[model samples]
Target: MFLDRVADNFLTQLVSEPTREGAPLDLLFTNREGLVSHVMVGGCLGKSDHEMIEFLIRGEVRRGVSRTATLDFQRADFGLFRSLVDRVPWEAVLKGKGVQESWTFFKKEILKAQEQAVPMCRKTSRKGRRLTWLNREIWLELRKKKRVYDLWKKGQATQEDYKDVMSNKRRAKGNLHPLLDVGGNIVTKDEEKAEVLNAFFASVFNSKTSCSQDTQPPELKDRDREQNEAPIMQGEMVTDLLHHLDTHESMGPDGIHSRVLRDLVEVLTKPLSIIYYRIIES
Candidate 1:
């Protein structure tokens, strides 16, 4: 038993009902007594073998709030967004400015208009969302599989019947199986499994190592190296590239969205080209 550390940590094990077969395999531990009660084994979820654990928290347990917000693209005002960027005179603003200065000014202008046009909403937690891919066919098939399993248990269905029902559950891709920890405890919950993997990776990561600090290449030996002209990039090329950017993709670390770029391609082409030109020239 896993009760040695449970007693040492002054925790109470509240689960008495078995989750599978006739053994109390699924354990529920709490630091406070009477905090959780009314523990029972509900039926399995989907085709999972282990039964679902049902319990209630006695008092108000305030969970931590996540302040992470994402852009509400459905209500974005692209008209105003483009208008704001169009009014900026890129040639005058970016004149006599270095590469970093040009990029910083461009980013500031874009972010300012983005805040006004694109509204932000709190990101919903994954546990509250349903899988979009789980359609009517998969649902009916799962029900049929459960019915077949019940019949098989009573010796009324053949093994091939159960196999036929299970063979159809492979339509969904990227399915994850239950993970077992080093201590042999089954981590069935998504959050618990994620934490276990994260902890393992963090334990093995070497943070003291550094890379590429002293690997700068030698200067070119050409006599005309200083006189060589930088490659020219036309505004049309930048506009074409921006138009081809997929709007469905997520924003990068710089907080600039692809949809906004595609929408304001004309306004951004000059500023982006100026920034790129300065970087190339340097």
Candidate 2:
């Protein structure tokens, strides 16, 4: 209950906190970009709200709290359930008709968090004339905590979720056609086009009747020369150079362009991986 109180207080602080610096508060739980946060509640059965709260706290701390993110109660409750043994008050809370009704509202929310594999917590609010399991404050605070949903939200990703998503995205991306760069313009392929009609319209109506091909820009030509002339560096060296370019003090157009070229060249020129180990007698 102490942890629940802390969770409540934390939620209250986030919701009541005045908007400063012209940033608006986030009211919706969509988990998109913005100033305000969206929290969730989740957990399995047979766990205390405190255990749920602790899991959330630990999760949020690990994930990095931000003004833009938060947790949903349904999700939080699930984490609580997973962390504790069956026989806690959580199950009792679901015993009564009123409690079951309360559970109905959160059922979808619980399912969503599990599907996404995010940490969850259990929450309880003032049970009175007007049922209030989760309020704006608690919702806001959950969003403020960040780590609980960090992996859950893509924007909502818990750290692992983020990595897993990125890995999948990367793997999926590997199947995707390489980004096509024609001259200096960025153009999405027909396959990536969101709407087929819009894509067709762009192809037929928006396209220029006759456009001259741009001569290779001086910057690009120089890059081409460097790529052509430079000997292939070892994988480790290429990675080190990439790190250096990325972390350079002056991060500007030139630096970014160089880094991109370096990375691309490294990828293009690197030899295929071969796994061979020599046997040695001790």
Candidate 3:
């Protein structure tokens, strides 16, 4: 009656052997049609009474996409870049300008310099192969192993060769697994490990839900007001700013880097400062 309510089928057949004498010990029940692609029954583990059952399901899996753009820094012409910046008439063009106007002029000049010096090109993002650990020898070994695996799967190689290749592959993968700090706890399950990591990061960067009533509002004094109002930026100040730019950081969508600014600081400082002064006046 219960089986009628569910409308399921008995997947296992009755056998005359003693091991399968009574009811089907290993049973698989499915209500949905075409759900299970294939079923397999294998030997029992160690001294276990029940047999091992395995099945495959039909579906599609999606993979993540990796995309990136890179600048042709090797072919960059810094000398021409400096010459372009030096040729800009900073005093004549950017004088008596608004913030937007000054920005437009400076941006135009920078774009011209970039067009001449640092041209950008697109390419697929690469990893692992570039690392010192995964060298040419390792790559060759991996290729060879893969070829051997294919051959074995096609019944052209011995079982021992396939096992050896698999062992090497496992060893290589083991070396690449990221080591995470989980507060001295050993997490076996992936879900538990992810939860632990999420909790740790949440605690570190947690923000207050409400502002305290006791906190006072900020008041601008005379000096503070003067500081708030834009001041005339000097050539030396621009040069100093350029010198302090971080070289290790990546470029923006505009394909310009702080390293490029720093490299051309000597030529750009005076022109940039003039543009800044115009913005301050406006």
Candidate 4:
């Protein structure tokens, strides 16, 4: 359960930074549903991005169990934690030159921590086991529970009413959450699973491209919109054509005939004419 909390905190906070150094950065948890919560990173060097994350992840796992928490402590099944980790595009996002090097070191460190936690499991878990099947089932159960919750919310069920129903269901099953069933035998439908996977990757590549004045340098933010309306053409010659088209008089300051002029240029200057123009007022 704390692993779930840790993973949730990671995604909710860490993914937005373009660089690792940007993490361990202060995060604002403002969701009205009370799902948003903050966890501070402690006992960290707080010097580099990777160090901070490792500190946070390790801290979450070991929190409040220090007497029991040792290099020999049995880590909670890596299943829950790994699921959360997989949702992050760690490899793809960290492909930057500096990050890649840091990541290599980070992975080794993480694996070492894993080894320290459960030395025997570290050795045997590599051969793989039947537990993967169980984990899959658990994920499926979670999907189903999520769907039911979604429908109830959509039906405008009151939070108290929904909680009561969920509580009854939990009691009948003797489980806290069906999605997190200990047995892990719930089968997930393909579509719902795909949606969850898609949302994760979408979040991975989803940096804000819109250069807001507050966030981006003012000059960089507005240049593309104010200058070129035409899409860039590829190839050396084709690129020239884009520039030529931009500069062509037909697309000049104002012209009812502008559209026609552009069409004509496209046809007549099919090879030689390349529009290179910036729409800047003199």
**TM-score against native, each model:** 0.45, 0.13, 0.41, 0.17
RMSD of each: 22.5, 31.0, 21.5, 35.4
- Runs in model 2 deviating more than 4 A are 1-175, 181-201, 210-269, 272-282
Ranking by lDDT: 1, 3, 4, 2
Worst 10 residues of 1 by lDDT: 222-231
Better of 1 and 2 by lDDT: 1
In Å, residue 175's CA in model 3 sits off its true spot by 43
Ranking by TM-score: 1, 3, 4, 2
**lDDT score for residue 11 of model 1:** 90
List model 3 lDDT by residue over 113-161, tens digit each. 8888877775433552265356456889889988998898899999998
Per-residue error (Å), model 1, residue 178: 49
Give the per-residue lDDT digits (tens) of candidate 1, residues 1-282.
Answer: 566877789998777888888788888889987889888887999988888999998998676564778788789998998898888998899888999888989999999999999999874555225354454566777798889999999999999988876776765555345566668576668898898888777766654332356767567785443433543556666776787786766689989999889988978988998888787788
Taking the candidates one at a time, how many backbone clashes does each contain?
Answer: 0, 40, 0, 10
Candidate 1 local lDDT, residue 40: 82
Count of backbone collisions in candidate 3:
0
Worst 10 residues of 2 by lDDT: 273-282
- Where model 4 places Cα greater than 4 Å from the true spot, the runs are 1-97, 122-218, 221-282
Q: What are the lDDT figures for the candidates, one per model?
A: 0.79, 0.36, 0.66, 0.39
TM-score of 3: 0.41
